[model samples]
Target chain A: MAKPKIATTSLAGCFGCHMSLLDIDERILELVELVEFDKSPVDDIKNFTGRCAIGLVEGGCCNEHNVDVLREFRRHCDILISVGDCATMGGIPALRNTVPLRECLDEAFVNGPSVHNPDGKYPDDPEIPLILDKVYPAHEVVKIDYFLPGCPPTADTLWEALVALLNDKPVELPYQLVKYD
Target chain B: MSQSVMFMIDGVQVEGRAGQSILEAAGEAGVYIPRLCYKEGLSPHGSCRVCTVMVNGRPMSACTSPISLGMIVENDSPRVAQLRRDLIEMLFVAGNHFCMFCEKSGDCELQALAYRFGITAPKYPYMFPKREVDASHPDIFIDRNRCILCGRCVRASKELDGKNVFQFVGRSAEKRIAVNGEALADTDAAVTDAAADACPVGAILKKGVGYVVPVGKREYDDKPIGSDIEAKRPAAGS
Candidate 1:
């Protein structure tokens, strides 16, 4: 029988979670034997070729493209797990939640001291994804089946959750595996 | 010495002095009843409700509820555990608890309770309420965003420090900790006051001393909260 497929993505995150996934080290060999990659940066697959048994989502929805990608993952995967603080609770990027969207844009595009945009214009290219008013955790956008809470959940946490899910065991992580920072 | 009163907590017979709260009795008996507002040397405010336990089948804040003779109390039960978890979750969602960046991440009682309960993320939707951060004080800062409304600072200021430096303002959802004066700096709040150290969350912080304890070396980093209290328990066979 064909092994189950796992898809992963980094939306508005810093890609630290993806680095932590790679932090699993030699376990990647064991994981490759257990599951196939689909629609993930791991295999450089930009789109889903088939249904995935699990989708590991990193970061929260910070833009229209992030929501679209998250919704796509929800549509293509049977189980979706929020992989870190960003995906679970809109981590560092969500600091903008308290600030007005216009002010944030102005600071970045106009008011910032280091900004070189003498045109005093915001990025309005049609190709650029529109930013959302507020950063939203993955579960707020779609039904997240599981949440691994960490600032980029430790590599052991991701590995343990994956192994448990793959083995059809309950994903009850030990105390040490669950951390917010 | 006061007369001893007998009570049953989770099927274990425990003895306490008259007028002692269930939480105090449980502590003496080596049962760590989780609490946030009830601190040693301070009056129990019983606002946080993290220490809620079943008293005669009814839920009551163990910190404020005095134990009576022959009283049957339930601590560490599933129903009470779930209640505590829900309370902790509400506190998380109600506040902008960005633990990833919070200076009180490991040392915070709220964060440690969440860790003890193994809460990955709060089940409730984040309110993300707009709150203010008062950095006016040169020696200290008050980040109202992380305030859990536990009233520890309020009590500590009035009762311990005798300064009345903090008090609750507004009503219901608008309620928050307000300084005695316009800002914390305007008040007579000293960095060394007990109120400064009484906050269970990152709401109150001393300036120039943040992240001094590295991540791995911080309290509650490896051990669960209340482990120190639990350690007072007599060995199983002793």
Candidate 2:
């Protein structure tokens, strides 16, 4: 029988969670033997080829594209796990939640001291994804099966949760595995 | 000498003085009753409700309720645990608690409680209310975003420091911690005051010194909150 497939993505994140997942080191060999990668940066798969057993989302929804990608993952995967502080609680991106969108855009594109914009206009193009008014956690956008709360949710945390889910067991993380920072 | 009172906590008999609260007696008996507003050496405010325990099947704040003779207390029951978890979750969502970057992440009682409860993320939606950061004070800062309004500072300032430098302002959702004067800098708050050290979250922090303790060496990193109190328990089979 074919092994269960896992999908992963980084939305509005710094890709630290993916780095931590890779931090599993030689265990990656064991993981590949247990499950197949689908629609993940791990295999450079741009899109889903088939349904996934689990979806590991690494960030929150900060733009229309993020929402679209998260919704796509929700539809394609049987189980969705938020795999970091960013995916679970919006992380550093949500710091802009208090600031007005206009002010943030102006400060970034129009008035920042380091910015060099001759036209003094915000980035507006048909191809560019529109930014959302506020960043939202993955669960706020789509139903999340589980949440691994950490800055990058240590490699052990991701590995343990995936192993438990793959074996149809409960994902009961020990005290050391769960951390916010 | 005060008369000794015996009560049953989680069906285990425990003895305390007649005037002791359930929380105080529980602490002495080596049963860690989690609390925030009720700090040792300070008067119990009973405001946080994290220490709510079942007193003869009725919910009461263990920090404020005195233990009567033959009283039955339930501290670690599933129902009470869930209640505490709910309260912690509400506190998280109600405040803009960015735990990832909080200076008091490891040492914070609020964060430690959340960690102890295994709360990956709060179940409720984030309020994300716009709050202020008062950096006006040269020696200290008040980040309202992380404040849980537990009133620890209020009690500490008035009862311990005798400064009355902090107090609650507004009502209901608008409620927040306010300095005695127009700003914290205008007030007589000093970094050495017990009020400065009383905050359970990152709301109140001393300036110039942060992240001093490394990640692994910080308080509540290897052990859970209330471990110190639980460590005081008598050895089993004694």
Candidate 3:
């Protein structure tokens, strides 16, 4: 049987979830044997080379770029898993949802206590990706097959879920493995 | 003289005191009924609805409903667990409960309940309502964003502490816990007030004491909530 291809991306996230993935320790060796990596930061692949069986997304859509990347992943992967609080429900970024977009921009750039942009300058360059009105979970933009919730799902949880998928068995979520924070 | 009430909870015969709530009897029997608005020593508010149970084929809040002789109660079933999960999800979406950044993450009862139910994602849409954080109090601050509206603080202030400093303001979507028609800083509330300790979420916090306990070391971090009550099971079996 062909090895399953897995793709991962960190969009509008702190990459803590990816760090947790590496926390799988010796299990990475087993993971490599069970699946092939494609279009992931782990392999430094900038774009998808072929269809993937699983796409592990680690953040919500905060910008147009993230939305495009998520849509691309949706088209190329058979199953897409939201892998953290960010991907599942926008995490900290979603906190800005309650505030007006202009106020947020001002706080980040213009009127911030540390900023010296006297002219009230804002990032409007064509190279910059447009920010969405509000951060949106990955599932809102594309179909999410599963969600692994955590600031970064504990390494044990990631390992257990991956092993379960590899064996085509039900994922056993032990009490200690699942956490919201 | 107190009368003994026999009941069956999930097919396990249990004995209780007459006029005692089903939740209280179940607790004495070492069965943990997940609840948020039913704190011990406090009046049963039965607001959160996380402890919904089938009492002789009728769904009722275990905390408010009294136990009876030969009563049949259903606890720890798939349907009941799902209902609890749904209530937890509604609480998650109803407020700005960002567990990752919350100081009350590990210690939060609502978050712990959600963890107990293994809620990966809420089935409801996120309602990021604009809420305010009242830091007016000298020793405490009420973050309206995280309040689950369980009225624990109100009851605690009035019933336990006798301060009557906290009360509900507004109705329905606009409803929130307020400080006796005055700003928190202007209120008579103190840091040692039971109202501060009564909040189940991060809504009411003592100033300058956020995140004192490190992550992974706080309450409910390694174990599920109500483990203390459920832990009594082994001893009860003896």
Candidate 4:
């Protein structure tokens, strides 16, 4: 009798998929009518203080904070959808899986030029978050109900998946979307 | 009109497994896709787009499409042929594909694919990315010019070997593969030899050549992988 409560959060992505979803423009608003936004960039609600029916996650688990976000998503939502390639296969960022964490940190913090934070002291400065050794897809750590999979999935594919869930049918992507055109 | 059907590729009737792409069916039926990025051991990256084929009527990458049981597929369509020529040429321009004076010259798949597709002249100018070679391993050498960004060696390091050694560091054309930040002088540290052996070009080299055949007896015998490369699927290592 009630519309489903849907929420979305991005952990470690360019947020390209969410913006691409906005590119759908009016349809994303149409999506708004069917699901209540709880904890999204579009909504101000911060903590998982209430129940949710569906949660859409749009990034891979790249660090400890990302891991915490995934666990919070799993706790609140009945079903979880990994909304992009980052959430599904760690996207292009997972390419960093080949190198050592120390090496990357050295480049980012010590050697590379952000200019102001050029010294290694900044990484050790307690304010900055710790970096993980490798980037991983969401499914590697959590139980994902479905995956929308694209660098950013097509709007129709996302729509079809939500509609399928509402209709109580199995929602798996067709080869076109899953295979990434 | 049935959602389920069977398709034929190159006169071979494959059972057409459900949820598989036409490329997979062709592979199962022993029909090769002649692609650079679709390795069985690694994740399918349709980036190279050399596996273009005609399904129904239009050209599409078989690596990404689901097989419709009654689908008609022409693996080596004129369009695919043209694209393969163009894509391989783009890869040549996109990086350094110097075949002559290279060790992997005779064995390189990119070169072999070019030879198979009859690419007599390169239609594009050299992109000349000019990235540095990562000779930072004891038994491996990564000549960036010859690197195609196929990510096979990258994947092989993470998935199979669990070493997590090869990764792309920058964005777009500036994208260069890195092995733990150090250049070749850091070879004394931990490096993966299996990942080195997985490169399809002279991009990664090891010792043990110059004895396969002597001069004069050295025959120019190159073959199309349109029917080969089924030899253990190259283990998904780039």
Q: Which runs of model 1 end up more than 4 angstroms from their true locations?
A: A116-121, B236-238
- Winner by TM-score between candidate 4 and candidate 3: 3
Ranking by DockQ: 2, 1, 3, 4
lDDT of 2 by residue, A1-181 (tens): 9999999999988899999999999999999999999999999999999999999999999999999999999999999999999999899999999999999999999999999999999989979999999999999999999999898889999999999999999999998889999
How do all the candidates rank in terms of lDDT, highest first?
Answer: 2, 1, 3, 4
Local accuracy of candidate 2 as per-residue lDDT tens digits, B1-238: 8899999999899999999999999999999999988888899999899999999999999999999999999999899999999999999989898888888988999989999999998889998999999999999999999999989899999998999999999999999999988899999999999999999999999998899999988898889999999999998878
TM-score to true structure, per model: 0.96, 0.97, 0.94, 0.49
- Cα misplacement distance, residue A32 of candidate 2 (Å): 1.4
Best by lDDT: 2
Give the distance in Å from residue B237's predicted Cα in candidate 1 to where it truly belongs: 5.6
- Which candidate should be chosen as best, given TM-score against the real structure? 2
Q: Give lDDT tens digits, candidate 3, residues B79-192.
A: 999888999999888888888888888999998998888788888888889998898878899999999999999999999899999898899999988887458888889898
Model 4 per-residue lDDT tens digits across residues B146-235 = 788877777777777777677778888888677755774453323444576567656756645523554213222333545453553334
CA-lDDT, candidates in order: 0.93, 0.94, 0.90, 0.69
Deviation from native of the Cα of residue A165 in model 2, angstroms: 1.6
Candidate 3: which pairs clash? none
| Model 3 clash number | 0
Compared to the true structure, candidate 2 yields what TM-score? 0.97
Tens-digit lDDT track for model 3 on A2-106?
888999999989999999999999989989999999999999999998999889999999999999999999999998889999998899889899999999999
